[model samples]
Target: MNKTDRLLAIVLELQRKEVVRAEDLATRFETSVRTIYRDIQALSEAGVPIIGAPGTGYSLMEGYFLPPISFTVQEAVSLLMGTDFIEQRFDDDYRVRAQAARGKIEVILPESVRNETSRVRKAIRLLISDKQVTPSKEKEYLEKIRRAILDERKISFHYVKKLADFDGNRHSVRTVSPYGLVLVQGSWMLVARCELRQDIRHFRLSRMTEFIALEERFERPAHFNLREYTPSDDRHLRVRLRFNQDIADKVKESNNHYIEDMEEHQDGLHVVLRVRQLDELLRWVLGWGADVIVLEPESFRNRIREEAQKMLKRY
Candidate 1:
């Protein structure tokens, strides 16, 4: 791109990140470090609140805010759809705020843009509102946990594991330094440094029976990065399975992380998977019902048999 565009891009990049190295900027812009430096200097001269520190990288001046930027019809529609999807997914306070924000954006849009947005919205619809699947208390508890995370405070919660204890409950109290919240496979998980585990632990939001934000504050490690955190690094469980012809195409379409390989056959399709846990795979196989069958891993077959027996007993 041209010099003016590069300078604006640099400003936006710095705004998004806490620190950005000159070398990284050079690589991103496909230019020399000298050129990146010159661009930074140009932005600084133009009264952009850019901060540069030795050894560390560049940042926007703390507390400096960017002026509102205009969005095209498509961009506005996408943003509105995003807000709508979030509303459909959760019944949190975020929904109200997002709706308010969308209204404000709609009110401020140019007449033509507003007309386009109205037309565009009429063509798109998001009907899925499955808030009942999530606990009503979850949104309130989510707010409490979010506040704790932002303030670098600890959180205390009573969690009930899916697998139960003698009394059919895997309930326990835990204290953790709030680190990150991750959404995976329709579940909200809190990844934290657990005092209970004496290590990083993942807690499902649904399992948390009670939660409290603690007054005790803690220092977040300078090197701590939520983006690098994976809830489970163990992908050791390997198994082979087969799907009947009825679901051969469906199984292929619902591409899962565990899928390692596949072989097509006249009657069915054989597949291999590398997964973290057997129960995780078992639940997925169960979802497919008669359309799927475990081809290998005798242990998996046994578990399926046991679960099937239990399910039949219930019926």
Candidate 2:
């Protein structure tokens, strides 16, 4: 980056953090320590309130901040689009905040840039299907869970699993320490320490009902991080399938998440997928009809045979 841009970025970085060491700044900007020293000197000469010490890092003076900066048309659009997404996907509180933020941004933009942003935004749309949109109850659950996580409290809810137990009971009550919330494929999932299971587990928000935040608080693990957590892989089953050549391209376009490996053959494509249960892939495989073949796991073949025979009887 140019020196002028780098200077501005350094100031912004200072505003973002309480302190930044010279070495850290050098690594972030991919420049030499000598260059950073020179840049710091230049910023100091330019009347910026930068304080540096031998061991301590650099920091700006208290209450010092950059004046309002101009945003390019593209940058304005990106911010506006972010607000739009937040409005559509977040809770009512955030939706109101996003609308206010959008108005503030639009009011400050240059008229020409604002007009161009509006024109460009008309061509780009964020389409959310009904199934993907956050439901009313889910939004309430999200807000409560968010508060619970922030307060380091436990939450209780009744969850319905995808399958029933031997007694045909699918509903169960759970009390968990809220860890974090994750959005996967437009659905909200809660990652938490399940007290009943005595382990961390993921629960879909949609399947949760009668939710309440408990008054009791719990201490979260210092080393636990939701971003780096990976579930155990022992339960996952590997199933291989062959797709007919004609629909191979379409299969690639589907971008199914569980697909681990794929290779092209003259007759078709060999695709291997990992899923928690064989039933998880049953409907997806059936969607391809005769064009897709289950290439491995004779049990899956028998399962398919039984399903196909059931379909034949119905026909």
Candidate 3:
């Protein structure tokens, strides 16, 4: 970035936080400490009230504030689209707040920029089908869960597992310390420390019933960071399958998430899927009928064979 842009960004960064270290600013701007020092010197010379301590970091002087910055047409459109998405996906409170925020943004923009942003937004629309929109019940649950997480409280609910046992037992009661919520593939999932399992678990809001936010408070772990957390891979099972070459394009178009890799082979298309259990891919493989063949894991092959045998008997 040019010196002018970098200077502006550094000031903005300082405005964002109470104090920022020179090393942090250097890393953020992809420059050296010397460059950052020079940039800070330039800002100070230009009459930006910057305070720097020897051991501590740099900060803007008390009560110092920058003038309102203007947004580009693209930036305005992006903000408008974000508000639209929140209005569609979030709860009623956020929907109203988003609408109000949109109004504020619209009022602040220049007339030409507003007109251009409106034209751009009209051409590019964010549309969600009725099925993709968050249901009313789920939105209500989201608000409750959000409050619980913020308040550091416990919540209890009846959860229905996606997979059922042989005896058709899939319901379980859970009490969890609410940590954070994640939106995955049009579904709201809660990542919490489950008291029943004594470990962190992900629960889909759609599968939860009898939800209640308990008054009992719990301490969330200080080290737990939702943005950096990744689910363990030790439980993943690798299942390899071969598909008829004729349907290779169709398989690719399906865009299944668990599919880790695919390779073209002389015999057919070699597809490898990583799932938590073999049954996850069983129904999908069976959907292709004779066109797909399970190529590995004797247990999975045997299960497929048994299922095919049952199907034949039924026929």
Once fitted onto the true fold, the runs of candidate 3 whose alpha carbons sit more than 4 angstroms away are: 164-169
For candidate 3, which ten residues in a row score worst on lDDT?
A: 231-240
Residue pairs in candidate 1 whose N, alpha carbon or C atoms collide under 3 angstroms: none
Off by over 4 Å in 1: 1-4, 15-19, 41-67, 127-133, 164-169, 253-263, 305-315
After superposition on all C-alphas, the RMSD of every candidate to the true structure, in Å, is 3.6, 2.3, 2.1
Candidate 3 at residue 265, lDDT? 94
lDDT string for model 2 (214-311, tens) is: 99999999999888988787546889999999998899998887899999989789999987778878998998999999988899999998999999
lDDT of each: 0.84, 0.93, 0.93
Q: Each model's TM-score, in the order given?
A: 0.80, 0.90, 0.92
**Model 1 quality (TM-score):** 0.80
Candidate achieving the largest TM-score:
3
Best model per lDDT = 3
lDDT of 2 at 125: 94
Candidate 1 vs candidate 2, lDDT winner: 2
